[model samples]
Target chain A: MSLQESGPSLAVVGVTGAVGQEFLSVLSDRDFPYRSIKMLASRRSAGKHLTFQGRDYLVEEIAPDSFDGVDIALFSAGGSISKEFGPIAVEKGGIVVDNSSAFRMDEGVPLVIPEVNPEAVAGIRAGSGKGALIANPNCSTIICLMAATPLHRHAKVVRMVVSTYQAASGAGAAAMEELVLQTREVLEGKPPTCNIFKQQYAFNLFSHNAPVMSNGYNEEEMKLVKETRKIWNDKDVKVTATCIRVPVMRAHAESVNLQFEKPLDEEKAKEILKKAPGVVVIDDRAANRFPTPLEVSNKDDVAVGRIRRDVSQDGHTGLDIFVCGDQIRKGAALNAVQIAEMLL
Target chain B: MSLQESGPSLAVVGVTGAVGQEFLSVLSDRDFPYRSIKMLASRRSAGKHLTFQGRDYLVEEIAPDSFDGVDIALFSAGGSISKEFGPIAVEKGGIVVDNSSAFRMDEGVPLVIPEVNPEAVAGIRAGSGKGALIANPNCSTIICLMAATPLHRHAKVVRMVVSTYQAASGAGAAAMEELVLQTREVLEGKPPTCNIFKQQYAFNLFSHNAPVMSNGYNEEEMKLVKETRKIWNDKDVKVTATCIRVPVMRAHAESVNLQFEKPLDEEKAKEILKKAPGVVVIDDRAANRFPTPLEVSNKDDVAVGRIRRDVSQDGHTGLDIFVCGDQIRKGAALNAVQIAEMLL
Candidate 1:
């Protein structure tokens, strides 16, 4: 359990994905403890070699026996694959850190963000050998709650209404390529086709986060609602989201309207956010300084700005803030690796 | 009011702006009957020529005497110019349709949208040139209420929460150029500058729409609240808006959550929207056919989709709908021209 000592070996599943590539890069950049590294993915990706830490390793097709000698496994494959193979990896004595939403809300599993809840990582029971599958919250949820959670400690977070401008990377590598290609086509005087998304992805914006449920809310919207509650541990924290996909390449930007139980001011909000673990506050409106997707795309920390007092509701104090984070970094890979770092 | 019979002439203020150019284009394309067209702008843009209807008209410097021989003047200029010259035009016996927020909520001035409130156009009372100014609603309000006003006829619209993906065109010509330049810089492997917006507009989204008010809401949010009430002729519609600027060019997208006094269904919503003038419902999820920015750009009607029942609250039906319309067209110029058409 000591990261100080040379730590146990690590395995990264789906190492070719946007998030998976970020995981490998973050691990090497952060110099996270590991005696050895293993790359795993589907059969088609097997035998493909990736270079990390000046060493070349071949990817092996993920199977039930893939985690036999591995100490920790990082998962970024699709949800169905994670749902089917996650418990099996756990069964083979590998502690699984899943980036998918498969077991996030399970009664027995622990959803962990090391910065917010490192103690939660210890709840992974040892004897279960279905080694603990630690769930990582969604990208948007992690970026938002990182700023809001610290404020909630001083005052209760009553409700949050978020509108997200998500990047193409969140949809995976091919979709990102589609965005780039479609944009190139549009610039070249051609109409971009709709294949990866319901609408055109070049120079366009639409509501394609997830399919809307029978409740008139899309799956992506519901995830922001449900995951925020799970992360903040407050079901009464009302959350409403209108998630949209924009033509951005990397960072996911969210405009969060939060109503607090107590009054919050600029000084207090800045003071709290500046001290928060993974938050950076950049609120200078006169010079027009605030976080944008390009500024936070490759960074580890969540960039926040436009932090000011809510003038609409007089009696019930509120704070209006904007947050941007690398969906592939803190939103996905860096967070998963951070959770693993906590356990080590 | 007769198209064939001309009194004096017509003038267009702010003729070089995004909405202004669109006004010129729509007028020419629709064969609007203007005996003569006087183009006006600031002293800097004076002496330029705007080609319309197979004729080139020299732009004049905006001043008090600019509307001397003008019978009808359409103002799509900023608030300051509208406030300064709208009355001047009205003083010269011109029926002024101001596309700015200057006279929108004035006590005696009428706010008109031809489709939703044609009665308002007819309701223009006989008065001196002093009270001749007519107000146009905000872009977001015009788009949202166009889709929702029909529903309100069948069910009371109790509350509405909207999240807008506004295009660069809403912020004027500089913003549009900023988006294009910033995007080009990003594609060329350079860090773009942030001037027109608070953040980098290339592949970045920021939530500072209309200035941020003291109460946490931005001017854009408050405008939606105030404009919707005035447009619907209801003082108690209960509107909440979170407006964010995305990296799109012309059309603005809105995700609306509405709660009605009575139960609503997807089929009924679809029917009402289809029959409503200036609205097109493209709600075939199975075929992946929904309204998108590219599809609705340069079009007059508001395109709506993602309609369903709200499963979260019992007896309180919910709907998720998207609206995309060219902010310059239906949101500004065409709407004003359509109001003039109703007057005729």
Candidate 2:
């Protein structure tokens, strides 16, 4: 693949979504070249006027012919919409980079976290006559793997246990608005409006709003387990997760425990993460300043900290790490954009 | 030891603090019999009026002579106060069940979780003309152990990993008030008050405010590790923890992973915990309702749920459990009062 002098035509699906908005911010920040861009949304949001990079654009209702001239389409409209439109976009001669879990686990579709598994998306690029679909890994998976894959590459991870502190943005733009509204209502001694979540979300956390599976793990957690195996391309690796919906507004935080097949010393593990691209090491013992959701809310880089030897394992056969990354940016839009950049 | 018909004299030190206030609630709710009671506090809280059990009482400043006729003292004053005053109460012929971490790891001082290790305070009684100090484990340790010990007894845990989602009450009464105030301020677009914690506690979670240790683990995390070994009476058990303080108000929750020396099937483990003392099983996958901080607030029993086999571990050698308990009640005051009841 080689960089082209002129970029391909791009389309932003679900332009009114939280992640969709971030796509524009990140595109503007990076100056991602695009010959033409289109904004597409649902019928209700279609006529809305949105300005991007100092130019006005109107959202068009997504149709069967929406991808007719689009060289690349970034989709974050819920899973159902992605499941329907993703294949249509690809079949219509447009490469689709999806943020939903639609085609993530399909055998033929590539689930790419560019920093962790760039090679999986090889031989695919924008403007190619044959269009294809590439899936973006879940937010929690992207943040955890951003720090873990560097160490996993050095010492193979045999098992992983993850606990996430997620924010409202994972649910979407209305959920974020609800969190703000609910907090204010709760503060004013009124009943909080529970539209998105069943239970109260102000100053509380619950199991991820994702429906629980019969196996007792929610879909959000299973995504970490299954997606890590696919992205790392190592099926023998074991993973379990307990996902919680915290009260934060945007960034997601995770406490990850890793057991390796081979010994990876803590200092060496820290050195590997420090040099890994797209990751910033924040392990400072003296300041007691590690990664917080508020610290990484709008940041592009996923922050890694609390790098220490797991006391449960003798010597350094295990390591524990804490990570934080913007839920909508790196976890969604920026990652899809990164995959698209690789396509060019 | 037989239960005494007429209970001994009881005194509550630091009666103005959060845990101190809960001491009165638990005592009155349980109908704990006491021949006489005294309210003790620092000079600042002295001369203040407090009513308990429909009787008005004045808070008295603690002096060396305060415990002359007192048979039992429930102390929740800070560690330094406990260090200076614990021995004085014991020397003045009163049994002290200290809530601070002062005497927890001492050679003869017993760390008691009434449900898990009641026998640790054996043969000690109020009004016996002799006194002894029994320590209450940290809130996180108590909640984790209340659920883990039942399974540990059946399978003999070899290694454990813990991650805590603690509440503001763990820091004390002022901290809880600050959380409410900070939430309102942040919701109004004003800077949050950061008096109790260094970072924002409104809609954010942070690594515990406890001091960081030399090994990069904070004091709160180490307390879970060391206290578990002491309470379980197994020094060889390997333990690691990452403690985080969430924005919740009262209850503390923990995600605990246990590796056992013997195989314990998930169904059998659930049955055992269903019958365990101080534990209530909430593992209903159908309802998708596991333990939440709000549900467990002001509740006596520790709520345990999300029990499942660790898919990472082969067969049944490992298990994962999530638990929540009242941080101020069972974690501190209720546990102290339970120890006092045993002293009778």
Candidate 3:
């Protein structure tokens, strides 16, 4: 029986990693069509077993031949792994949707947010016989732009200042476990086990662990800056970001200040965001309820609140917003799956 | 025995609250001279016993006559308690160093940050046989200004943007206990206990619990904006803030962006902060170490790091920095004690 009879054959690289596992969950949740599936991971996890949609699968070591017959490949391993295997998968006639920073800034590779810039992957399809590479923006950038873009379209955003309260899940599943273990140890009057991070991760927060660039912006913060420019396709838009890792499990919250080229009042900006797709408004001034990381822990939609005019700016020229989104879902797995769906 | 033999007689109001306890600790730590001391609280804690400097003391119920013959009083109860009793203490000839927001914006009260604006209370002395009131700025404002004021002095900051990651101690002792309990409960696969806050606060964060105003800025946020102007004595300075409550125990972290009228490079800003009193520089780019709340938990000096030129602005006219300071130490009790020390 031909695997392509009902739908495309699929391969999931880094199937044992955090986002890799999430990719499978998102695919199953979305009921993505697949005739046959291959689970690929590093040599250490090659013999592991995983079940998806009541079907059992044995993980295989990733090799050059892994993508030989694959139609669409989802890559979520670290950047170095993606760097080594991404091109090979494409060369093997598999369309690659990568969740690493490997080729996000590559000139010819289209960095896409399906909700914001679906047209970036205009003609690429699973059955087109031509293999293509699509890069997923960084999680902070994806979560920020998901809320900022709808308003950016209504009034051109000239500058944006973002401060992120990121979650442990952005680091990986192991880091989330480390946080829990550390919290338990600290509560018991024992020194916390600091395996995933160098310092204490429970009941504490710190700057992002990404390496600091020469300009003093960490890799994580610069990703927000550069990815916003690329995804919006507007090089003139200016951005600055301060990324912090909080102790939350899986969701991220950002405080964004936007300076626009045109006047956009708070009421009008709220109206625009209300009609925007994939965005939920939780702003209730009377109830004092706004979007929070815990409230959006496992949700797919990005929540935006604290909508108000920037009092420091000239009348109606700037707005301040708070946003929360599940880092592993909309920020990573769900975003990549949406890109693959566009290809179908 | 005359109680005024060595120094002024002192009174500590709200002696059972978190900041109130910190007040006693700081006074003892500083070897503050006091001939007589009174521990006063509400009726709920009237019979409570507290030990200070190896001496046992009973908490007395606060009354209008509680301030009689008292040379200085430190108030940290809620706003209404301070509003009703603060002037009463002053009327009884005791100088009041208030840690509440009751008189922060009053026309005659001098809002003081000892490190930044000690001169505002030059003439108010504890033993002048005259009563006075001094206001301590909010914790978020105190932490932000500790780092920003030095740069603002050199380059004349025209606009400032701040985002805060606050701790549970700002809500009081019960809130801190609630956070610990909720964390333990959540780890045990049970619903978290939600008492101090309406939502789960373990491994999660939310916007500040301050009442949201009509303009969409919460009271905690407005305090930062308004207090900066009052403390700096700069009515024209533009300030905006977003206040968030993180799961941290005691320290508050702030990300501040400054736009200055004069050009100030990152190096110069670093030099200025290095010489600024009550501020420490922790900007180690190679080690990827910046200020974190855990590192600053009980520290008296505010830690500043992540200092960089704002790429979004032109030619050294703007910069960004991250700051962390203990909410109870430098933010509240320590600041009030410093104000009282100035009166000596």
What lDDT does each candidate get? 0.80, 0.89, 0.93
Per residue, candidate 2 scores C-alpha lDDT tens digits across B264-315 of 9889989999999888998888778899998899899999998888877888
TM-score of chain B of 2: 0.97
Which candidate, 1 or 2, has the higher DockQ? 2
The weakest ten consecutive residues by lDDT in model 2 chain B span B1-10
Question: What are the per-residue Cα lDDT tens digits for candidate 1 across A13-126?
Answer: 999888889998898788787777789898888889898877788988888878776778899987987988888878778888999988888876777777776767775632
* CAPRI grade of model 1: acceptable
List residue ranges in candidate 1 displaced over 4 A. Answer: A1-5, A117-119, A125-130, A193-195, A233-237, A259-271, A307-314, A317-319, B1-3, B6-8, B123-131, B152-155, B193-199, B233-237, B259-267, B310-314
List runs of model 3 lying over 4 Å from the truth: A1-4, B1-4
How high is each candidate's interface RMSD, in Å?
A: 3.2, 1.0, 0.6
The C-alpha TM-scores of every prediction are 0.90, 0.97, 0.99
| DockQ-based CAPRI category assigned to the predicted complex of candidate 2 | medium
How would you encode candidate 3's per-residue C-alpha lDDT over B1-344 as one tens digit per residue?
22347789999999899999999989988888889899999999999999888889999999998889999999998888899999998988889999999999998899999989988998888888889988989999999999999998898999998999999999999999999999999999899988889999999999899999999999999999899999999998999999999999999999998999999999999999999999999999999999999999888999999999998897899999999999999999999999999998
How would you encode candidate 1's per-residue C-alpha lDDT over B1-344 as one tens digit per residue? 22345433678899988888988888877778767778999988899987777677899999998888677788987899999999888777778889998889898788877888877766453223333788888888898888988888888787776778889999998998888888777777888877977567777777745666655567888888888888888887777776778889988988777778888887888899999998998877655467788889888888988776644334546565778888889999999988766544
Output the worst ten-in-a-row residue range by lDDT, candidate 2 chain A: A1-10
